[model samples]
Target: MGTCKCHLKLRKPEDAAAACSKVLELDGENMEALKNRAEAHILAERFEQAKQDAHKAHEKDQNDRSVMEMLQRIDRLIKMASRKDYYKVLGVDKLTATARDIKKAYKKLAVQWHPDKNQDNLEEADKMFKEIAEAHDVLGDEEKRGKYDRGEDLNEQPQGHPDPHTMFFQNGGFPGGGGQRFFFRQG
Candidate 1:
């Protein structure tokens, strides 16, 4: 246990996990070992393993603040993973994408999915358009892209951040600022 703590304090999470694993082998119900292992997994970007250790720690000590925090972090990681991937939505390859690549992909997808162009499948097109717009809005901005890359929560729009829908209109997605009220069927 002390060895685990020492490794964690030295910022060696893999070593800490190994130490915690050793302790768990001797005492499987050790709360400290579970909590430490969970945190180490989190730092290692193994969210699934972190989730398991966090749940086990929570089960052993429901009132532990560290355990609760681990659970919360695990939840955030899970939610972030499940959210729409902006790169996939924009059709840009994340590994070799430049800003120009992102913009070109967004333009192509937006035109392809525009509601006016897909009148036969208006609802689906509108949904696709919105997704494309949001993907562009995030991936286009460096600050937002950095945060997104770090896997931070971006559910709330910060003050002054442009709305993806309005941004599409401002970029002349619709001729003469027309289509928002008529083209998309509000459900």
Candidate 2:
């Protein structure tokens, strides 16, 4: 557990996850190991895996605050990832949005969520602003929009463009975005 905590503190989540795995092998019911591994997995961007470990921890001890918090965070991240509807982000109807309408919608959202305009919630606003920009960048381009419409992974990083979605998930999941609801069940 000390090694796991040290690795995690050093931001070496992969190493932390391995250390936690070793602990789990020795003591499967160790809530601390389960929680630590879940945190490590979250840092590693393995939300589904984290959720599994968190569920196990919860089953072992539902009263554990840390375990419950981890479960909630994992649930939120899974929900956010599964609800990647760019059209919904831009407030455009996927089926009927014209290029002009898409552009208009994007502009509106961009202004509304601009960090400069929402200083009190700068981080949240900035995230929303980026999402709007990404949506616009894809929807404004005919080819990219076509691919996105067909359910391709628009979250994939471009050659030189950093992936905001990855950063977003790493930090704490999507702050606030309206889209289709997704449910994940523990099996």
TM, every model: 0.54, 0.47
lDDT of 2 at 36: 91
What alpha-carbon RMSD in Å does predicted model 1 have with respect to the real structure?
Answer: 13.5
Per-residue lDDT of candidate 2, residues 1-187 (tens digit): 8999999999999999999999999999888999999899989989989989999999998788888877877876776567668888888898999999999998888889999999999999999999999889999999889867654555666666557786567656764433447899999
Model 1 alpha-carbon miss at residue 27, Å: 3.2
**Candidate 1 C-alpha error for residue 113, in Å:** 1.4
Task: Give residue 16's error in model 1 in angstroms.
Answer: 13
Q: lDDT of model 2 at residue 20?
A: 96
For model 1, name the residue pairs that clash: none
Taking the tens digit of each residue's C-alpha lDDT, what string does model 1 give over 41-96? 88887899999999888888888898887788788887777888999998778789
Best-matching candidate per lDDT: 1
Q: What TM-score does prediction 2 earn? A: 0.47
Give lDDT per model, in order: 0.88, 0.85
User: Which candidate should be chosen as best, given TM-score against the real structure?
Assistant: 1
User: TM-score of predicted model 1?
Assistant: 0.54
